[model samples]
Each structure stands twice: as structure tokens, then as C-alpha cells.
Target: MHRAPRKKRRWPKILGFTLLGVVILGILAVVFSVQLNNGLRSATGKDTPVDTAVKSQLVRGIEAKKTGDASHDALIDKAAETLQQTPMKTITEAAGNQQKAAELVSQTTGVPEASAQVVTQAIFNDSKFDGVRKAMANGDWVQVYQQGKTLSSDPDIQALTRLVQ
Candidate 1:
């Protein structure tokens, strides 16, 4: 006698593929969430621990304006910025380069060149900074962070600040 033809089950294969697709979508969702959260954290306009760092160095510039290091101040600034600028040695060809520091302040803060002299006077070892004085000079000064931006408007300076930071 001829054997009867049997039906193939399609349910198992279909269920397996569906489960795989769900898992893949789930992973993508998680990765996207993490990226979005990080970007938002920095712009919360409040301290959200976007970056917690500790920097130590002798602060010059102004004697009376003396305060804590840049790393700690960054968290306190409430603008999601680390007021501390990158060291001259790390970003410039010269180790104790004064010009680079001046540029960052001038471009970032729009301060008169005459006022930025204090920027060159401070000494740092790799990572260091106290307050705005880290980038200050002479009698008194101001702030700028756009590209150097504690408050930045120039695209060129903004791009430059991003590169350095």
C-alpha cells in the first residue's frame, strides 16, 4: 500500500523568526535611549552630573577671586560646562605656551587683549585650574565659553572649543 502524504508544520519556524525580530528591535531601542539621555543630560541647565572630574593646580590671575578647581566648578556652574579650559601644553606645541591660552580667552570671552594677560601668568601641570582666573589676566576680566563657551556665539570659536574640549 502507498504511504499517506504528511503535512509540514509551519508554526515553529514562524514563531522563531518573530521572536528574533523582537529581540533585535529591543536592543536598538536601548541603545537609542542611552544616547539621547546623555545628550540631554549636558543641557539640562542644571547639574546632572554630566561629568564629574577633579582637577588641582595653583590659581593665579586674581588673588581675591580665588575659588575651587575647574572640574568641581564645572558641576556647579549650572550651565553644564566645565569652566576649566584645556591646558596650553596638551593643546599647543609649546608646554608653557601663553598665546594659546590668550586666544581661548579672547575668542571665548570677547575680553580686551590687555585684560587677558593674567591668562599667561598661571602655571599648570597637565590638568589644573581654579576659577575663571585660570583664564584671566591683569586687573580684572570676564567670561566666554561658546566654542570656549560658558557663553559662545562665534561658530569658529565654538568649533575650536569643541576640538579642544
Candidate 2:
């Protein structure tokens, strides 16, 4: 008489291990996607901690200048320099591409492209505020008057103008 073949019990173990592997892979993918999003935000300089700190420092320096604190002039200058060195080059460079520039400006400044373009023009227009430039270079009162004339309407620029004043 032929003996009955013993049935293998490996299917349960294989299925369990396969399910565990799939769950682990799914978790890893989720983690990786989250990290990627964070990195993209950081790279774009959107609401970054460093940007917030720099903006605060700039505001404080401007306020100090308004208070006639001569000691803070150096601080104001340093803060201005820091802001100028920030990674806004992309926004600035997009000027040649109207649509792209507008979109970038809107995203960065939270303003419509039309308004953002005006602000950008004011900020980048060196010839329009010759007096302000001179005043900034020489630390003269002309900076106060010229900056008020040139950028008084823009709160952000007004704050920056205080650095020169």
C-alpha cells in the first residue's frame, strides 16, 4: 500500500513574512515622501526659520535707527547686508520672464503679481533713488527724506529705509 504524502505547512509562514515586508515598505515610502516635501519647502525658502530670524533682526535694527540710536547703525547695516545676501536671487532673476517673475513674486511676498512687480521694481530701481543711495553710502539725512519719498507706501520697504535713516 502507498503511503499518503505529508502536506507542507510553509504557506502560512511565507504569507506572514510577505505581508510584513509590504507594510514596512509602505511605512518607509510615507516617511520618505514627508521628508522630501520638507526639503522642498526649505530649499524654496518658504517660511524658513532663518528667514524669520533675519526679518526680525532687520525690523529691530530699523526700529533702533528710528530711535536715533547711533550704536545700532552697524547692526542695521549688517542686517541689510544679510538680507541682500539671502536666496532671493531666483525671484530677482525671474524679472525677464513676466509670468514666471509674477508667480514667484506672488508666492514669495504673498501679493498679486501686479503689486509684487511694483514693489520689486521699487526695490531694484537704483536710479530712481539716487539720493537714498548717496545717503545710505554717506550716512546722511538725505536717506530719510529720499527713502520716505521713494518707499513710504510700502511697509516692508519703509522698514528697510529706516536702516538708512
Candidate 3:
């Protein structure tokens, strides 16, 4: 007697499963790469960590202000006020902090005297400016990070981002 006909396996099911596996693996790889990239960025003074650090500091300052930490709060307020003042006054003060870097950013970014003054003043207000200034002078990653942090915390940066977009 002839053997019963062997069942013909459906090619579609096999292909579908293989395609599904490939898609899943692709997604997983992308996620892993993103995570690895983030880790590397944090270690190398990249923008992400700088932005996060600045944002955290800003939030802490707000909390301090809310809790009535008068000195710290006042410092923040004074910095904000300075930025709103005339550009020459602001730039003059910033030049005392990091003359070269401040000058570079102002020139390279093509910021107007007024806006550059405010921006540089906001940068100098951050207590970390000394380290940042050194890094800026050397054109190091640290300076890039510090600049990113400064820009992230500055209200002017957000405003500029909005304007450019």
C-alpha cells in the first residue's frame, strides 16, 4: 500500500516567523545601541549628560527657592536680572570671567552685542564657570559639556531654540 501523502509544509508560516524574528531583533539592536550610545555620551562629556545636569541643577535651584533658601535664591534672581540689563554691562562682567571663550561663542554664534552680553552673563552666573572657562580655553570636551549645561539652563537658550526652529 502506498504511504499516506506526506503533509506539505506551508512556506508562508515559516517565512512569516523568520520575518518576525528579524524585525524583533532589529528593534532590540536599535534599543541596545541607543543605550550604549547614551552611556558613552555620559562618559565623554557629551550633550545629553550636560543638559541633564543643567536641568537637574535648575530644578534644585527652584526647589531651594521654594524652600526659602534666601542666599541661593537671591543669586539666581540677580543673575536673571543681570541678563535683562544692558549688553555692555553684562559683557563687561562676563569678560572678567572667561574673556576668550565668551568672545569666541559671541563671535562664532553671531550673537548680537545685546544677546551675547545676556548669554555670556548667564553663563558666568553658573558656579562651575572656572572649570568651564579652562576647558573652553583648551577647546576640550569638558568645555563643550559645560557650555551645553550653561545653554540648557539658560532661558535665553530655550527662547533661541524656539526662534530658530
The candidate that achieves the highest TM-score relative to the unseen native structure: 3
* Candidate 2, 1-165: lDDT as tens digits: 998999999999999999999999989866564344335545785634433454565566555554446666665665555455545334323543445655666775467778977865764464545455444323233343556466667677677766756
Scored by CA lDDT, what does every candidate get?
Answer: 0.42, 0.55, 0.55
**Candidate 1 lDDT, tens digit per residue, 1-165?**
998888899999999999999999999866564344334543563322322121122122222232477764553452223234443222222223566666655665567766665644553331333223343321012221111234245565468556854
Of candidates 3 and 1, the better by TM-score = 3
RMSD of each: 15.5, 15.9, 13.6
- Kindly give the number of clashing pairs for every candidate: 10, 0, 0
Candidate 3's displacement at residue 49, Å, is: 23
Better of 1 and 2 by lDDT: 2
Residue pairs clashing, model 3: none
lDDT of 2 at 160: 77
| True lDDT of residue 155, candidate 2 | 70
Query: How well does candidate 2 match the true structure in TM-score terms?
Result: 0.25
Count residue pairs with overlapping backbones in model 1: 10
Ranking by lDDT: 2, 3, 1
Tens-digit lDDT track for model 3 on 1-165?
789999998998999999999999999866565454345554664445433454455445545443366775666565444333323323323445655436645664566666766777766776655555544333244444667687668787678756843
